[model samples]
Target: MAEQPKGRLVDVELDDTIGRATPDVEHERNVAIFDLIEENVFNPAGAPENGRFKLKLSLVDKRLVFDIRNEADEPLVTHILSLTPFRKVIKDYFMICDSYYEAIRSATPQQIEAIDMGRRGIHNDGSTTLMERLKGKIDVDLDTARRLFTLICVLQWRN
Candidate 1:
């Protein structure tokens, strides 16, 4: 069946101590939240098409938690995913982001663009992995998955 408009996400937030450290990741967090809320398909498996659902994302015990709720704030279902599958891609993404950041400071524009291309490639890899892992648990489009992956990486940020 075609996805309904009510299947879209309205709100997204972080749950607890998981927070962003770097400025780049902070910007990514804000952008991800904005992009998700503005327009994104996010239908939790078997959940009704309610346009007012909210999501509280978090990490605990090395697991990624998707705390979903209805318009009334009633509990829906919490999907827990093991972080093991995301480690390598996230690490590669971080490394490329670090290179992009440094490139911004000293490298030529062409060099910066090259690093950014690699960064985007790694980001795509992470998003694809996330979509695969979320299979049978939640339904999301590519844009939605990409934004969600960015948030996941944001939660993994540390000093």
Candidate 2:
């Protein structure tokens, strides 16, 4: 379980904490909590070339839920759920640019699976959901429970 820092979430940013260093590397090194809040960011010029999808980051009780809206105009296009193409592009883009990027880009399937499993563990502890464990079982004071829930919700897993 991640430590519940003694401050508000809105007050913190990765850049402020790590200065000019690569935020992803710093995060990996420190095992920091990461939340990728990819909102519409209002691409009034219009969404991505592949159309728009609602990417919401919100507090559900204390959990930061990644609500991804799946919408596509073409059936021939593979669905975004697999995320393989997205992963490929990210890797290819970084691979062309920097050697350091290799660490992040060339992560083994085992590493990816472990990351996914960690998230699943947090979200699904055996038969009990994370929300249930934090709120109902894990022994803690009322305030700690409230804050811990908030922390867990906001921490997200991403490519």
Candidate 3:
């Protein structure tokens, strides 16, 4: 006998029903994460508080998931370089901040002044732009300056 076409062999009536199709329990598990970043190297008004920038890292079913929330009003291009710390959970967020600024904000006299004032007249015994101090001819953008300031602050805070 010729092979019959493979069809539903036992076709009676299979009720393909899924339980809990309409459930409120799913909504209860939903959560919203808020992240905040402040770039306030010039003044304290824009400094971000601890835990303001939230990054969520979780593993689900053998897959890694990352949730990053930045609650900043202005985006990266407008700000160029925002001196925000990064969490391992969120990839490329802070790196973008660093690169975007370094590519755009070159050393300016105003930034030189601000850094000098912030550092308490500690630039080459006078007013020397960040680029001038490096002696490497690298573009000293606002991000680099802010990073130096942050590192200094961290060191001092540790002391």
32-147 in candidate 1: lDDT tens per residue? 99988998888788888555688999988989999999878899999899999999999999888888988899999999999998898899999999999999888788899999
The lDDT for every candidate, in the order shown, is: 0.86, 0.32, 0.27
lDDT by residue for model 2 (34-55), tens: 3212211111122233334333
Please give each candidate's TM-score: 0.92, 0.20, 0.19
TM-score of 1: 0.92
Off by over 4 Å in 2: 1-104, 126-152, 155-159
lDDT score, candidate 1, position 19: 39
Count of clashing pairs, candidate 2: 5
Evaluated with TM-score, which candidate comes out highest? 1
Per-residue lDDT of 135 in model 3: 31
For candidate 3, give the lDDT: 0.27
True-structure RMSD for candidate 1: 1.8
Model 3 TM-score relative to the real fold: 0.19
Using lDDT as the yardstick, the better of models 2 and 3 is 2
